[model samples]
Target chain A: DAGITQSPRHKVTETGTPVTLRCHQTENHRYMYWYRQDPGHGLRLIHYSYGVKDTDKGEVSDGYSVSRSKTEDFLLTLESATSSQTSVYFCAVLRGAYGYTFGSGTRLTVV
Target chain B: TQLLEQSPQFLSIQEGENLTVYCNSSSVFSSLQWYRQEPGEGPVLLVTVVTGGEVKKLKRLTFQFGDARKDSSLHITAAQPGDTGLYLCAGDGNAGNMLTFGGGTRLMVKP
Candidate 1:
């Protein structure tokens, strides 16, 4: 919460549109993650970055893409957002043995 | 498939009540972490328990890692209205590389 920040707290877009969410951190942590929370599904990892320009897909990486061109920023992009993609997205930074610190989250709705 | 399963999806209790929420998984983890999330915000880390049969206390929250390393529990003593939030348990399934989360337990502590 102290170092991580997510932009555009809330957004509403039409189906088939492209959307991007940004997560910025001041802690300079190497591991940054993107997760989506849905009812009955809890939170599922979409993607994560271990370092600048180093990324990997998570359990639910179907229609999502991510980029971490710098250590302080990680971006999650949905090429073609669907109604089912409407949910809360959270950004997290792993702080080694201390666990993770999460951003405030971005709420997205697709109609 | 959901790797972690949380029981008692929802819990409502009066102030000063005690409650326990559980997280179970068939797969063993290197570590387990607990988080509390409030409305419109992402989850914040509460505690991280490594090692089997480990127990950690944070104020009124007591977290226990199962002896088998396949489960964990959170017991809240004298839960107050301030404790009303979604409690989530996550496992580091990849030996601290990635986390697999459980369906959260939503607690409502009415005053």
Candidate 2:
């Protein structure tokens, strides 16, 4: 889908540790987003980037931060991992009006 | 605080049965999209309805958007086991260049 890729497909980290998830795209789409999927809660947006160096917070951005230093890369960092943050995180690139193209996602576990 | 709500959070049916998933919202959207997600993978876009009252069909799946552009539905006819996955509806927010997703409906079509 859109040549979007996510790194560290799976990871287990201790609580209070910092973890960063990477999303890279080959299509050079200007908009990228990070979301976490949890059972019963659905997918909640953490943050999104409109362009290099431009970013904004989404509904569930409290525990997450994002950086888009380059057009092809968007990074999502969990400052301090918590049990509640253990979930599958997805990276999506908006292909204009056609909608989003998502990466396979990264599953994170905090213990 | 969820802008969009999906009914019947979970559904299980036998193959050949028909099922419809509903996504309702109080606010209007520029477009609505349907996605299917399998276990351990990111969601894949199935269809997008842009106009109010617009209806689109793909194979045995049908998607409909409300006349008010505030709701949408996906109906699957003659369901198959391969159709099992999480179904999500997203509304194009048209504000932040992002989408608002509904709590997905998990569907399982048993053979």
Candidate 3:
């Protein structure tokens, strides 16, 4: 709670609408990631930022994009929301030795 | 292709029973981590294994990393209702910033 915070804990939107989920971290970790959880697919990585303005795609990066203008903030944007994108989105910051700290997730529902 | 596959996607057991969750991968990792996530919240780190053939324990839960560093496992002894949740395994294959997660194993310990 003190280290990281995710905005818009729950949201409902229609298809084709654009949506953005924000993750603000207090600890200045250099790496941040966005992942979506589905029933059988597990947690699939969408995008990740290694540092300010440096982003890379993960296995499931087709419909998502990420931006990190500052070391403490990373945002995930869905250009066109779809029903398939309706799932829990999680933000994680990486520390040394591959240790990660996760923020409370945001549940997005796209109709 | 999914690198990590978790076994027993869902498990329902009684209190005091023991359960083991596996996270297997073909790629070797620099480190492995176990997390427990409750609904509506983020996954919390339980333990991390960095060395090959390493084992770490937290109370009734035990975590182990494969000798080749390509897999990991978590064993919960004397399960309780509080232990019920979605268990996740994550790792960094080559010492990078982000992690690859397993499909996740959901366990329910009945009272």
Candidate 4:
């Protein structure tokens, strides 16, 4: 619980719908990351931001996008949700030199 | 791409039993981290190993980093029902700030 908050702890949306998840942090950490946890795949990085307005794609960024408009807020958007994208998403902030503090997580289901 | 492979996707044992989980990789990492995730919650940091051949202990849990910095192992002694959770291993592959995670080991300590 790194003072991070993810909106809509649980969400269910229809396929092809646009969905966005928000992550807000109070610590003002320099690095923030978005990851999705799925069965048999562990947690895969979707996107990460080093600083405000500075973001980069990760291993599984094809169907996802993110933005960091301010130091405390990072947003992940799915332009068109799909069944394959249903999973538990987590937001994390780097802590100290070698660890991370994660938020509670958001569970999204696309039908 | 750097990948971490974890063995024994699932483990179930009676309380008081001992267990070990391993994380292996083809790529070397600067450091490796272990986390425990409970249902509906995000992963919580358990330990971090930075030096090769390093061994650290926390009460009933012992963690060891391989001499090559390419692998790590966690051993839990007298496991309890409270220890049941999804265990994950992560490393900063390519020396990047982002982490690559293993498939994870689901442990169930039945009382």
True contacts kept of each: 0.94, 0.84, 0.88, 0.94
lDDT of each: 0.92, 0.93, 0.88, 0.93
Model 3 spans with C-alpha error above 4 angstroms = none
> Once superposed on the true structure, which residue ranges of model 1 sit more than 4 Å away at CA?
none
Query: How much is A1 displaced in model 2, in angstroms?
Result: 2.1
Tens digit of per-residue lDDT, candidate 1, span B13-105: 999999999999998898899999999988988999998999999999999999999999999999999999999999997643888999999
Clashing pairs in 3: none
Q: Candidate 4, residues B1-111: lDDT per residue as tens digits? A: 889999879999999999999999989999999999999899999999999999999999999999999999999999999999999999976444889999999999999
TM-scores for candidates 1 onward, in order = 0.96, 0.97, 0.94, 0.98
Give the DockQ (2 decimals) of all models: 0.93, 0.88, 0.85, 0.94
**Over the stretch A1-111, how does candidate 4's per-residue lDDT look in tens digits?**
469999989999999999999999998899999999999999999999999999999999988999999999999999999999999999999976748989999999999
Report the CAPRI category for model 4.
Answer: high
Residue A87 CA error for candidate 4 (Å)?
0.8
Order of the predicted models by lDDT, top scorer first: 4, 2, 1, 3
Judge candidate 1 against the unseen true structure and give its global Cα lDDT, from 0 to 1: 0.92
Better of 2 and 3 by DockQ: 2
- Comparison by DockQ, 1 against 2, better one: 1
Better model by TM-score: candidate 3 vs candidate 4? 4
